[model samples]
Target chain A: MVRPGGRSARVQASVHAAVRELEAEVGREALTVPLVATRAGVTPSTIYRRWGDLQELLSDVAVERLRPETAPEDKGSLRSDLEAWAEQFLEEMSAPTGRAYIRDALLGGPDGTNAGQCSAYAAEQIDVILDRAADREENAPDVETVLDRVVAPMMYRILFRPEGLDTAYARQLAVGLVGSNDR
Target chain B: MVRPGGRSARVQASVHAAVRELEAEVGREALTVPLVATRAGVTPSTIYRRWGDLQELLSDVAVERLRPETAPEDKGSLRSDLEAWAEQFLEEMSAPTGRAYIRDALLGGPDGTNAGQCSAYAAEQIDVILDRAADREENAPDVETVLDRVVAPMMYRILFRPEGLDTAYARQLAVGLVGSNDR
Candidate 1:
């Protein structure tokens, strides 16, 4: 039996596929709703109704691409787990394409739901790390603190200054948080 | 001397004044570039050329308005100063109008220069607090740490999950940083 959003998922898949193909062919600058819709076998109105506009559609696709497909790596300790997770987070988010995706995620209009979804992904990873710490009886900071201390700074640097983001910087934040919190 | 950007400054002032007046009268939805140009006594081309378009003009003005006009209030100690600054920052950034301005500021096209300017304002305030701490010989987190620990979290909360942002929460971040860093 098909799930509730099966048809919708198919449409989204086709649309995303169309975008990738067109991007590779003519590039992002020359893309439009009609062209993408034609390639995806959906009407232009459908694209507009669902995604609001071409830019939002592109942002939706990019944000979806950014969704983590697998759990963060297990590094045996809370500190190492956080460091590894944060390093991957910074690497993916600090690249040029990643930066564009981050920017577009926030620009999801007044509701700003896309940015919230992105934050939730980070929070989930932190929770996993915290759970590992719990199992090991190791001290740990709360997920909120991890978000505030590690993830926020990386994202802040990515969006604004956008320089000097590296594994060392990411590891520093994790180590500092772990040190202060005894986690 | 008139200064290099004299005419540009006047145009910006008149345009800003026009936006405020029109926002109060006709409301934001009804605003158009030609209408603002006529009101500000400049040609539409001037507004378009300088600001790119109506949305860009509106964003430029909002970012300009968001710029800090004065130095952060000094409270003698680094902890108090950071707490005060962070609380004020969260309050301003989480407010409805402030949120809109921030969104627009980042939406300032590909360069994202407005976001950079906003970061500079916070960094400058942080520097002042650090300098004060230095004078008092109080151990203090560096400017980057302050940006990471306090300001980044506040901004992340503001942009993503905007609820539950308040003075107490802001104070907690500042106080926690000080406790950790011996400042």
Candidate 2:
């Protein structure tokens, strides 16, 4: 059911909206192909044609929804750039959707299942931050280390523990991860 | 049914064997109070006497079967301590059973059903490493920082990623986290 030319603006909007609604209601699991098609009032074929498969569709939606907000505007120093990155990371985690995403990543599942998706997504995000840090000659460690030490713990505390994610904790992690990179 | 005092050593051994067999076959999901009692050749009441509920019995079995091995002799440095921890963490993630346990934690289902059980179990494991690190004044960073950076990341990586735990990546994290505290 491909539109004669390409997916119409309305069809794309409807598909995106369907994904958002499902994700909000029940995390990532509930967004099955049929469910999204039904919600979008489009044929399943339409979704398949546009997004290829469930994972691709979900990944696309996840990327759009979970994209880190505005990149840091050229902070003069590595420390300041990292501080900006940490603040942004904390802001993302504080949101309801961000918390849900973190829980899914942490407790997600085993290898070859959907469990790896969140961590992979997170690693990509860290790469972006690391690239920014690298531009300033900072000794930002590899993406995996950044994720394991800095991002995962914050998400874990927020999702599983009663202890809340606060500015103070975020700042501490910032100092430990970024400032300590060279020291 | 209360074992009329206490079960004979043979009876206790039989019960433990049954638990091990059931866990090995169908996993924790397939385990049931009645099935365990039947396999053990004991009355349900007898099983209840020893363990108050199915989950308790399962938890006991889990603790016995999946207990962490003793840490390696410390090399009097944070780097060695972290590497020892990383090796153990990788070993834990290598098992199908361990992966399933983590998957269950994430999808512990609605209503906050298994949340407390999962949280308490994870906290106990974390406490062991945290306490051990705390004893090493020369090598370990402050307790809170170690927990945040080193411990949390290891757990998160094991439970989430499909790839072999990145030992070099973890080594770098340990150095960065502990080295920063020295300054």
Candidate 3:
């Protein structure tokens, strides 16, 4: 997507791309402002002046990259809709890049930087599903409830445990949250 | 708890204490093996040989510190028992030191060093509660189920959000997991 802007927008885009590429190659731990500056064809001073620190740059990158590229299509039922959304989410988050993005977003800080934006994006997806369900006379759980019951647990295990998330796990969570086995 | 051992065990204990103190003082991000070695009155070479890296040393300290000092006492029923356990667990984890321990434990690695041990310890707590409920002819959800439905969500928010955990949250989780409000 090309942004209709001048030199400032071009530099911002370049920096964002550099951060993502560097993060993927060396992992989040190894990424540095100097390295990003080199990769983005900008000076270290520019990066420092624009973002203040690596954490803030990471927060910006995470906020941009972690948001769903497109909204999930509304499936017929709450169960199917939730499962589909979760499956897509899990798939995205299972990749090394996605995982790194989420880790930065989540473990960043209490400051309303990346984590808050990322969470709000996630909550919007849940709201889309719940709103669709309400239209079908289905009593869907609230966004926080669904997040607590399904999304948080899946992400918890994925981040902390060796076990990977799968479709079956997503289905089970959907059933658990919705209190129904109907597919 | 004193472990009856020679020079190696004593060194390990001192190093662990130093790690905890340093973590509490400077937070985990600023902690280093050299600092810990200096504080513990050991050579940096010793730390390098035993723990391999700062992350590994952190994993060890976190595994040791994050485990419950004593198993939670079983209340009469599953609901009360779960609520009691969760409240205590949340209280411990809400502290800065405890939160640091948990962050180290959870975000430590995919290496299965600290995360595996920490998860096992948590599973054991769940087992104790379930076993007690079984003795009273009451049904209890499996460890994974309870973790998915209750503990994971709590931990996720604790780590990611600024919101602190409380008894009300614990009670709601207990009720949600057990599928009943009956005590």
Better candidate number, 1 or 3, judged by DockQ: 1
Candidate 1, residues B26-137: lDDT per residue as tens digits? 9887999999999999999999888898878887888778888888888877778888888888888888888888887787867878788889888988898888889988
True contacts kept of 2: 0.50
The top-ranked prediction according to TM-score is 1
- TM-score for each candidate, following the candidate numbering: 0.90, 0.62, 0.87
Candidate 1 backbone collisions, by pair: none
Worst 10 residues of 1 chain B by lDDT: B1-10
lDDT (10s digit) by residue, model 2, range A22-77 = 87787666679999999999999999987677766665555456654555555665
The TM-score of the first chain in every model comes to 0.92, 0.62, 0.81
Residue-wise lDDT of candidate 1 within A42-130, one digit each (tens)?
99998888888887888777778788989888888887888899999999998877887877788776687788888888888889889
Tens digits of per-residue lDDT for model 2, B1-183: 335345566666787789889878887668888998899999999878866777566554554444445644555555565656655655564467765554444444332334334444445554555456567654454545555665567666665564666566666666666655433
Query: Model 2: clashing residue pairs?
Result: none
Tell me the spans in candidate 1 whose CA falls farther than 4 Å from its real position: A1-5, A179-183, B1-5, B179-183
- Prediction 3: B-chain TM-score: 0.84
* Segments in model 2 whose C-alpha atoms lie over 4 Å from true places: A1-16, A22-37, A42-64, A69-73, A104-117, A130-142, A159-162, A180-183, B1-23, B26-82, B109-139, B159-161, B164-183
Ten-residue region with minimum lDDT total, candidate 3 chain A: A106-115
